[model samples]
Target: MQWIPDWGQARIESMVANRPDWCISRQRTWGVPMSLFVHKETQELHPRTLELMEEVAKRVEVDGIQAWWDLDSRDILGADADSYEKVPDTLDVWFDSGSTHSSVVDVRPEFAGHAADMYLEGSDQHRGWFMSSPDDLYRDEGQSALPPGTDPRLYRLMARAARCPSLSATPFLRRT
Candidate 1:
């Protein structure tokens, strides 16, 4: 963040420090389910959540979201299905989209690499999608995604290119 404005840095820092517990599940008819399996007695994730996640993903890849909506846990888990519970809750909007960088971008060869040469978002997302990025990347790779000296150029994506545009081509705000 050496190049980031001081106030921008501070604002994001504040939001990160006060962030709330994440909710990765939702109740909805149209969305991807969280694909989490829980121990029937403890309400904890099954020991093979990752495997189950992949199984669900493979089915989704072939049949689309309906694969999850129409799944029969017993067919996948076999006898263990009686001991674990498949959560029907869909992923929260934020958790689903916020994970795209890791899930989609990182795994797909064509999209693999730095998320972007420049990452720009409104101040409002500091605590939501933008803030979730660092931890999400680190959680998977054991290090922050933004390598040192490779900090993304922070800028706001403005809605316009210029103002008083009836006469001039000059932008209303140009970088100094």
Candidate 2:
């Protein structure tokens, strides 16, 4: 992958080599829900998780995300609702952003079965989106996220711009 600024490649390589595995779940009021059912006592996923998730997906497609929140556990779990509880955690922002290849880019009719050609991200994303995106792509497709010959670039915020008045309302970057 091609990165702007010669040092960017090394910086990203070092972060990837040293960073810890990211946690992909968080308890948040907003953001994509995990929509999982776990055993009340054991906290393990329900045995029929794939089937249940498909059911949830069908509902979500028709009614949007609020359908999951409004749904009663019993509606999906039947009598097992007493033993299985819905997981309230939402996916981490990094995980959600990282999976955009499959979730967004790859779903496009023109781009089916292909990876994105470019990924524009902030320089700070080396330890966040940069790492997570590649990892997710590799896990799902068994290859690096960037196709051969693709260029990946990161832009850093200008220090002076960050200190400017709030009226600017945008982080200016010093593109190299």
TM-score per candidate, in order?
0.77, 0.80
Overall lDDT per candidate, in order of appearance:
0.67, 0.74
Worst 10 residues of 1 by lDDT: 167-176
lDDT of 2 by residue, 4-102 (tens): 666888998888888887678998899888889999899999999999999998999999998889889999999999999999889998777767667
Q: What ranges in model 2 sit over 4 Å off?
A: 140-142, 145-149, 153-176
Could you give candidate 1's per-residue lDDT for residues 120-175 as a string of tens digits?
Answer: 55556676667666666575558766446564645544446323245321111111
Predicted structure 1, TM vs. truth: 0.77
